[model samples]
Each structure stands twice: as structure tokens, then as C-alpha cells.
Target: MSYDLLLTGAEQGDVAVRDGLIAAVGPGLPRDARQVVDVSGRLVAPGLIDLHTHVGPGYWSIDPDPIAWFSGVTTWVDAGSAGAYTWGGLRRVATESAVRVPALLNISAVGLAGRTGENRDLANCDTALAIDTIQANRDLFHGIKVRIDAEVVGVNGVEPLRRGLAAAEACKVPVMVHIGAAPPAVDEVLDLLRPGDIVTHCASGIASPLGPAVRSAAERGVLLDLGHGSGGFAFDVLEAQLDAGLRPHTVSTDLHARSVFGPVFDLPTTMAKLLAVGVPLADVLTAVTKNPADALGLPGGTLTVGAPADLAIFEVRAEQFSVTDAHRQTRTSPIRLVNEATYVGGRLLSPRLPAPPAPWVPLTRAQHAALTRRERHIRDLLATPLVDVDGLAEQFPRTKPRSS
Candidate 1:
């Protein structure tokens, strides 16, 4: 078969495309038909699918393309930012977006107004309305989202989750529940979820002491997803779980306005954090790609013979990079995954995130200092680094040990 482009990576091959679907892929193929662009010496894989991101009409969400395209995520789901009362506004925004947006319908009618919790009032938990909203927009609606944080639904208890689970059952879709500090307890929330249901923020300290209930729910096929948001990821919590052999089914950045500036920068950075935490690189790749797509039953995770040519080009470099969790704990990794460009439906997109760095470019003083400061919270939360302020020029650099 003829080919359009060849992405030579660890899995080197010439990929062919016809009407958006990948027609064929192999080495030394007939370069017979169309335009051919060669990207040799890069890492190529399926476009990332983040199962949990908070993207709406920019209330809690950041403009998704700037964050997603830069991170090589072609598809993402806005966890719980719009509901029955605010769905129209978000729907309008999704229509104008550059990224492929799939949303998990929020249980609260008001969705996430400003940064306020959506499930404060018991009246906001409307199963009938949630079902109607999903039926209205079956193209965009994929599942149910309920943030069962203690602060989110103080007195409302787990009624929102109950309503969400009920709606999910009626709609025959999965429910993605956000587990935070317990008011009704984590086990009660776990009990309500069915197989294929997702429990996000599995690494947060808030969802503590997963003894039998979490394990039992996992045995029943309940999926655990990483939802790294502000105060949503803690190193100790993740280490404890990882040591106990609990891994996330999907890795997602709850990228809103709050997290885009620090800690939870983007999907690539989030995946890098998991790698730093000792998860295998292949495991990290699968969590962001196939696991999320399979969980949601999407059609474009793998580069199958007849699948849409959604792909991401990445550069994996070895450097002294550090990642900080929400609890102010830090970990460093020698291998960092950086996104270069992305393609959706066989068409390459102009990158919106900054272009990838050289294979081995050193970080500038300002850049290095910023990263060090972000992680130094583990040591002195109040104190600043004691570097020579006068010698901070890019040319006169000092190689200091990275802060943890």
C-alpha cells in the first residue's frame, strides 16, 4: 500500500492513510501515492486520551487546546464542569474548540459554578435531568461525573453519587466519581459503583486506608484513575498505593485554571510524574492511551489497520528533572517525556504549546531555578533558595543539585 508519512521511532514504520483511517504500516513500503514527511529519531504513539480534565466555558477550565495540543493529547473528557443547568453554555464552547471533547455529565445541575462545589444542595442531584441531558447530546455525553468530596457536598452526603449511579445504570454508561475527604466514607461510595465505573484521585491522601472495600471494588472491575489536580496528588499516598500494587487504569491531569501554572502542568508532565514514582514507562503509556480509550469504549486509541490516524510525536530525553505532588513532596526522574507535535485524523496540527527542546539542551538559570523552587516546598516551605542572585545570567550557570 502507498504511504503519506513515516514516523520512525522505537517502533519504526511507514504509516499509510486513506480517508483518515490508517491504511497500512511497514518498512520499505512503496512511497507511491501522496505527500511524504519523515520524522525519524522520535517516539511515536497514539494520541493521548485523558479521561479526566475540567474543561468547560472557562469557569473552572482553561482553554483546552493550548494545554492539550502542546501535551499531545488529542482527546480529553471534562470531568464535571457542566450539568443540566449549564450544559448549553459548555456545549457552545465545545462546538468551537480545536480538540475532540467528550464530557462526563455532572450530577449537579449547576455543574461546577466558579470553583464552588456542585453538589451542595440535595435538590441539585437530578437523575431525570441528567438522563435527559445525555440523551440530548449523545455525541458528546459519554458517562456520569460526580465529585463526592466532603467539602463539595457537605450536608448532601452521597446522595449525588447515588443519583449519578442510578442515572448511569439507566443510561448504560460508566460513572466517574471523584473521591476526596470522606463525609459519607469511601467504602459507601465504592459500594455504589458498578463494574467499569471509575474512582479518580486514587493517589490523594484524602481517599485513605483502602483496606477491603477498595480492593473488593477493584476485584469487581471498578477502574482506578489518576486525577492530579490542586491538592489531588500526594507522593506518600501514591507510594503507599504503588507499594501495595494498586495502579491507575487511566492517568489524567484535572487541568483547570488553578493547575496549569504549576504542579499539574500538562498530561506529559503528569505521565512523567508517574514514571518518576516507579511505574513502568510502558504502563504510563498504556494508562494514558489504550486504558482510557477502552474504559470509555472510544474507537481511536491504537494504530490498528482501520483506525483513525490519531498520533502524537514525542521526545524522551534524559535530564535532571523533578516533579512535585500536591502535598509538597518531590521526586526526580532522569527520563523526561516531551511532546513534539500531534496529528488527528491523518492531518498534522500546528503546535500551540512551545516547541520541544533539543535532545540535550540544558535548562537556563531562570528555568532551573523555577523548577527547583517548585520542589523545594518539601524542604523549606517558607524559605527561598540561597543561590548567588548576581550570577544568575544564562551564560554564567552553576550546576546545583536539584531540590527535592
Candidate 2:
């Protein structure tokens, strides 16, 4: 049968799409499609599912489509950027985004309107409210999120997490907890997580969750997420976790307004950082694609027939690339996954320029200059004529002055 689109010559074999789903994927699929793209020497994998990100109406939120088109991240889970009170705004953003955006509703009703302290006011961590919100918006909210940090939770300690878990239990959804610097010890937070719960920033340098509690949590089926946000990841911490047989179950860039520019540029870059740390390419890909999908119970992580045709094509360049973690420390990766094209539901995603960073977001001078240079370049390109006079074809040619 003729397909709607066919992608040939990829490492994973030819992929055929029909009705916005994968029709077939195998060696030398028949070139029977309305549109056939020869993607020789490229690696075509399932569109990446970023398990954690902020692309909602909040302090940290950024437009996901501009990054999604080139970065191959078709699914962006807005991790706790919205709570019950602010869910409507986030829902609107999710509805309008070209990429899929499932979210983890914050336990606090205030949400992330500011950088932190969503859970500081214990009054906002209403379990009943959270449960009701999840019940009402099950289509958009997949789970619950609670930040267990010193500054975020304040004197409340793990009370917010407890409430989040209570809500999650009621809804039968998992809870993804963000861990950071602790006033309440890390163990206090880790001990309470139930099976299937996620511990984002599991290898945080600040929290340094390299303890028996963390190991026990993993044994009990709590998933670890490499939420490499502005200050979540540390090379030393991750390496230690690997040594201790506590590898992250999933890797996600907690991509937000603050971390989008550096450290956690995009999902592929975050994957490359794992590669630099000695994780196999297959494992890295699984973490970004399959593991994340499973973690959140979202779709589009495989090329199987009938799955959503969300895929990413990459030119895997074999070279030493210097990759950095949230900290300034850097490591060398032997390969780089450079995305050439991205597709969502069999439709090619159009290129979109990112909007300028929010004024409040801090940027290094170099980053600031780079953004300026990029804007100027785009302006120049658009300002130039599409084609010279010689390249134009005359649709209405005058013939002998109309024989007058």
C-alpha cells in the first residue's frame, strides 16, 4: 500500500508513515509514498521524549516548538510548571504547541510563578485540590510534582511531598520529586517515595544523594531521572552513582528559561553528556526515548507499526566533543548526535527561531553576544533577495507589443 511519507537509508532502516502513524519499518521498505526522503548516512530514531522540562506559562517556561523542530524533542513534559491555580494557562500553551506537552501538576496551587518557593506556603500544598485537579485534567496531567529543596519547602520539610504522594496515590499516577539543597535531609525525602515514583536530579551535587536510602529507593522501584537543570547535575555525582550501580533510569533536560542557553542546551546535548560519562549510545537513546515514555506513560517512543510517526533524523558525527554538566566541569564525548530533521506525526516540523531570552534570565557575555550575532545573521538572510533577476521566470511575456 502507498504510504503518506517514506524515509529511506536510515540506520534503523526505511520507515513508512500512513495516517500519521508508522505503517512499516524494515530493511528496504518499498519506495511507495507521496513524499520520499533519502536520508542516507543518518540515524533515524524515535522522536525523543524529554521526561522533564518547563514549557508552560510560568517563570521558567519557554516555547518548546522552536527548540523541538531542530532538537528532535517531540514530547516535552512540563514538569510542575503549573499547579491547580495556573493549570488553565499551561493547558492553553499545551493545546497550541506543535509538539506534544504532557505535564506533572505541581502539588502547590501557586505553581512556579517565581523561580522557587512554590511549596514554602504549606497552605498551597492542598492534597484534595491536587487530587481534584488531576481527576479533572487527566488528559493533560500525567502525574504530580513536588520540589523538596531547602528554599522551596522551607520549614515544611517533606510535607509537600507527602501531600503530593497522597494525591498521586489517589489518582494512581506517579509523583516526580525535584531534589536540591536540603534543609530537611535527603534521606527524609527519599525514604517516603513509593514504587514507581521518580526522583529527578537524582545525581545532584548539592543533594549528593549517594547514600543507602537512595540505593534502597532504587531497589524498591523508584525511578531516577537525570534532570540536568541549571544546577541539578554534577559529573562527579553521576560517576559515583554509576560506580555504585545506581544508573539513572531516564535522562531529561530540565530545560527552562535559565538552563536552555547552556549546560542543558537540548536533549541531544544532555544525551551526549551521558555518553561522555561512559553510558552506551543505545542506553542513552533508550533513556531519552523509551525510558522517558515509560516513566510518564506517554506515547511515541518506538518505531513499531501503528505508533505515532514521531521521529528524529541525525547525522552522527564521530569526533571528540567537549560536553559540560550543570557545573563548569567538562568531559569529552567521542560522538555527537546532530539533528538534521525532526518529524511529528509524519509531518516535518518547520524551523523556528527562538525568542530572545527573558530579561531576568542571566547570561554570560559570550552567550549574550552569540544571541545578538545569531539574530543579526537571521535578519541579514531574510533581508536578502530570494533570487536574482536571472533566476526569475516571466509568467506573462510581451509579444511584439501585442502586434499593435
Candidate 3:
């Protein structure tokens, strides 16, 4: 049978797509398709799923499409960028985005309108309202998110988390809690999480969650996620976790306005950081792909027949490359997964330039210079002609009038 599109000669074998789903996958499969792309020697995997990100309308949020076109992150989970009151705005974002945008609803009604202090009031963490919102918007929301830190919760401590958990429990969904500096200690937050709950920024340098509490939580099936935001991750903390036999279940870039420009550039860069920390390439791939999908129960994490046709093609360049964490600590990765193309539902994503950083988002002088240089380079390349005269073909050739 003919298919809509066929990917041939990929390392994962030929993949057939029809009706926006994988029709078949194997070696020597029928190549009868409307379009065929030869991707030999390229690593073709399910589109990367970022378990923790901010793509909704908020102070922290950024457009996911501009980055997704090149980063191969098909599913951008907007973790707590919106709450019950602000969900309508987030819903619009999901509707307009080119990639899939499932979200974890924030517990506070204020959401992330400002940088922090969403939960400081406690009146915003209305459990009943959160539960109702989740029930009403199950299609877009998968779970709940709460920032349990000193600054965010202020004197309230884990009360906001408890409210979030109550909402999640009522809705029968998991909760993804952001861990950071303490007033309520890390133990207080980790101990309250249920089996399927997720702890984002598990390797945070500021939080230092490397105690018996973290270990016990992991042992009890609590999933740990590497949410590498601007100040979330530290190389030392990750190394210690690796030494302790506690590998991250999923790798996610807390990709938002502030972090997108620097340390957490994209998902692949975050994966490379994992590679530098002695994680196997296969495990790293799983962390970005299947593992994150399973964590949030989203689709498009495998090439299995009947799965969504979202895919990422990468050139696995084997070379020494230096990758850095949020703390400016650097390490060398043996390979770099450079994305060649990203596809969603069998359609290739077009190139999109990201908007300038928000005014409130701070940038170092070096970062500012780099952004300027990149813009200049793009402008220079686009201003030049794509091809010369020889590359063009004349459609209508002038002929002597009526050789008759």
C-alpha cells in the first residue's frame, strides 16, 4: 500500500507515515510513498519531549516553535506557567503552537504572571478551583505543578504543595514540583510526593537535595527530572547523583525566556551535558524520549507502528565538545547530536528565528554579543542570493514567431 511519506536509509530503518501516524517501520519495507527522504547514517528517533518547560503566557514563558524547529523538541510541556485563572491564555498558546503543548497546571490561580510569589498569599492555591480546572481541561493538562521554595512560597512553606497534591489526588494525576532553596527543607517536599510524582530540578545546586530523603523518595518510585534552567542544575550535584546510582528519569530544559539564551539553550544541549557526566548515549536518548513521555503520559515517544509521526533526525557527530551547566562548570562530551531536521506529524518544521529576549530577562555582555553576532550572520546569509544564473531554469523560452 502507498504511504504519505517514507523516510529511507535512516539508522532506525525505513519509517512509513500515513495519516499523521507511523504506518510501518523496518528494513526493506515498501518505499511506495509520495515523498521519500534518504537519511542514511542519521539518527532518527521520536521527537524529543521536554517534561519541564515554559511555553505558555507568563513572565517565564517563551515561544516554543522558534526553538523546536531546530531543537527537535516536538512536545513542550508547559510546566506551571499557568493556573486556573490564566489557563485560557495558555490554551490559546497550545492551539496556536506548531508543536504539541501539554501542560501541568499550576496550583496558584495567579500562575507565573510575575517571577515568583505566586503561592506567597496561599489564597491563590485554592484546591477546589485547581481540581475543577483540571477536570475541565484534561485534554491540555496532564498534572499539577507547584514551586516549593523559600522565595516562592515565603512563610507558607509546603502548604501550597499540599494544596497542589490535593488537587492532583482529586484529579488522579501526578504532580511535578519545582525544588529550590529552602524554608521548607527539601525533605519536607520530597517526602510528601506520591509514587508517580515528579521532582523537577532534582540536581539543583541551590537546593542540595542529596540526602537520605531524596534516596528514599527515589526508592519509592518518585521520578527525578533534570530540569536544567538558568540556576537549576549544577555539574557537581549531578556527578554526586550519578555516583549515588540515582540517574535522572528524564532530561528536560526548563527552557524559558531567561534560560533559553544561555545555559539551557535547548534539549539536545542538555542531553549532551548528561553525556559528559558519564551517562550512556542510549540512556540519554531515552531520558529525552520515552522516559519523559511516560513520566507525563504523553504520546510520540517511539517509532512503533501507529504511533504519532513526530520524529527528529540528527547527525551523531563523534567529536570532543565542551558543554556547560548552569554554574559555568564545563565538561567534554565525546559526541554531539546535531539536529538536521525536525518533523511533526510527517511535516517538516520550517526555520523560525526566536524573538529578542524580554526586557526583564538579564543577559551578560558576552551573551548579548553572541546574540548580536548570530543575528548579523543570519541577515548576511539571507541577504545573499540563493543561486546564480546557472542554477535557474527558464520556464518560457523565447521562440521565433510562428516558425510556420
Candidate 4:
């Protein structure tokens, strides 16, 4: 094909890009005119899209471009970094900075910041304000973000959720609710969520669980996204949910300054962890690319002709890696991998890195006790051998009995 530029290689390749869309693809092309890339021994795929991230660096105190472009994540959705009150500021600083950062306005006025129990105020979620903010910033704000955690919302129950949904309906958009242990069941949140709406942090601690809830959500056509942040991802919960045929609609890093140190190093690392956990490479890519794009109602990732030339190249290496979440639960799994580089519109954004170091920190007495309690509860569920699905046995294989 007569193309403007191309990347000639077997494992990875680029295409002719005009303006911002991909014009042609496949190895070999003109040596002059525009530019040429050589991707030799790496698998090339569409640019990673993180459906959930707190990109508000100023107020949310999370770095914006820390991992977005460098970690192969071309686009990200800021999950509740701002609300009606701070939406304008977030747009000016965070969203318009360097990468693509669509926002999910928090139902609470101050967003996930302010105080711990800010969402419990009830008055923070002025439906009118939420609707107005969403309408005013229609292009930037795509959905409502309501965190339905017991600790985050205290005794507010589903008031924040209700407000979020009401605002979403008014704005003609979906609501993304953060689900974990909470008052109004995850099922309740799923029941309220529509087909286009999103449920983030779907699989968290075992106390609240995620399998049954995810099954229900899938049946209801609600989208479940892996908001794998520091504290929001539980290995046991994800393994269980996936085994039960409850597949996530998206795989997001939920990347923040706090979660980016080691455990949740970057989006590529997070994706590799999921791959190690048994999610197929194609499925994982779909979750991060097409699925999230569809959920966010954006058009970017994909190698199909006429699409954007955004891409990521990765090399899966044979190495052992330890994955850790916010709760300090560590899962040491073999088959570690990392990103090689990233491209946006046929332009290389950032090169990838080598395998990351371990991220587990020494637990204190109180923290260790808490982690023990959490692990024991998860074990209780795992002990009763699942009879319904043999898939569970394969996904979360254990040679030794889980700790009691």
C-alpha cells in the first residue's frame, strides 16, 4: 500500500497517520516523506485506556501524567477527582495538561477529597448542581461518580448514589459507582445502574465479595470495571468473580501517586498482573481498549483502518512478579511482563521499562492483624470447595491450604 509512514516488523508495526487518524497499516512502507518506526520483537496493540483514575493532581493530590503516557495508557478517565464545585479547576489544570483525561464528576461537591465523611453530608449532592455541572461541561464530564463504601460514606446509605443517578439521568449520561463493603448492597447499586452505566472497583474485599454481585450486574447488562487501585483490588475477589463467568467490562489502573510507587507501578504492569491471574491477553486488551472506549463513549484505540494510530508495544518476559494492592495483600505469581513503548497517532509517546521491583512493605502489628482478618474471611469462602464451577479450581490454584 502507498502509505505516508510505516513500522516494518512481525511482532509490532505502525501505519500511515494523517492529521490524527490511521491511514494504512502492516509492515513496510516509504522510507521518506513523514517518519518510519522499527518495532522488532514486541506485540503491538491499541493504546491502553484506563477507565478509572483520579487525575486531579491539585485537589485530589494525585499526579496526572505520572503513568498515563509513559505506561502506555493513552487515555484515562478521572474517577471523582472533582465535582460540580471544582470541575472547572480540574479541567483547566489536570484534564488539559498533557494526556486525554475525561472526568467523572463526583456526586459529592468536594469530590473524593475534603473530609472522610464528606459524601455523608447529604447536602453535598445537590442534584441541581450535579446536573448543571454535567450539562455545562458536557464535553469533558461523561458520568457521575459515587463511592458506595461503608467507610467512605459512613451512614449516608445510597443517598450519594441516588443523587448521582438522578444527575446522570438529567444529563443523559451514565453513573459510575465505586462498590465495595457498603450499606446498600452492591446488588442494589447494580440494580440501579443502567446498561451504559459503570461499576468500578467491582471486586474488592471478601467481606462484601464480588462474584455474586458481578454475576447479577452482568445479567442486568451493567458494566463492571476493574478499578484496581491501592485498596480497591482483592486478588481473591477477582479470581472468584472471573471464575464464576463474571467478566469485567474494563481494566483500569485507577492510577494515582499513592498507588504508582511499586505494586500498582503502571497500567501495563496492572494489565500483566491480570494476565498472570488468567485473563487472556486478547480479553485483557479488549477490557483496557475497546471495552473502556465503548464505556466512556470515546473513539481512539484500535488498529482498524480509519482509526487513530495510538498503540502500545509490549514484551512478555519469563520472570516472577509479586502484585500488591492497597490492603497489603500480596500475590506472588510467575510470568511477569512490562511495556516496551507507547505510540499516539503514529508518534512514539514513551518507551516501556524492565520488570518492576517488589512493592510489599513490612506490616505493623495493627495492619498485620487487619490483613489477617481479611485473609481469613476470604479463606472461609475458598475452603468450601466450589461444586458449581470447575473453573474456580483452575483460576485460583493453590498447592497449600489458604491461611485461616
For TM-score, the strongest prediction is 3
Weakest 10 consecutive residues of candidate 3 by summed lDDT: 395-404
For candidate 2, write residues 138-207 as lDDT tens digits. 9999999999989998889999999999999999999999999978899999999999999999989999
TM-score of 2: 0.97
lDDT of each: 0.80, 0.94, 0.94, 0.72
**Could you tell me how far off, in angstroms, the CA of residue 336 lies in candidate 2 after the best superposition?**
1.0
lDDT value, residue 269 of candidate 4: 75
After superposition on all C-alphas, the RMSD of every candidate to the true structure, in Å, is: 11.7, 1.3, 1.0, 15.9
TM-score, every prediction: 0.85, 0.97, 0.98, 0.80
**Model 1 stretches astray by more than 4 angstroms:** 1-4, 8-12, 353-404
- C-alpha displacement of 398 in model 1, angstroms? 53
| lDDT tens digits, residue span 1-404, model 4 | 44455655735344566666778666654554366667676677788888988766333345555455566777778888887777776787554545677788889887755425658788888999989888888788888888887776788888788888888898888899887775767677677777788888777663345536556667877887878876678777787887777767898877764565544667777777687678887888899899888887877868778987777766766787777765666665466556676766666664323222123333347655765675687778779877767554587776997888
Off by over 4 Å in 3: 402-404
Which pairs of residues clash in candidate 1, taking residues 3 or more apart in a chain or in different chains?
Answer: none
- What's model 2's lDDT at 83? 92
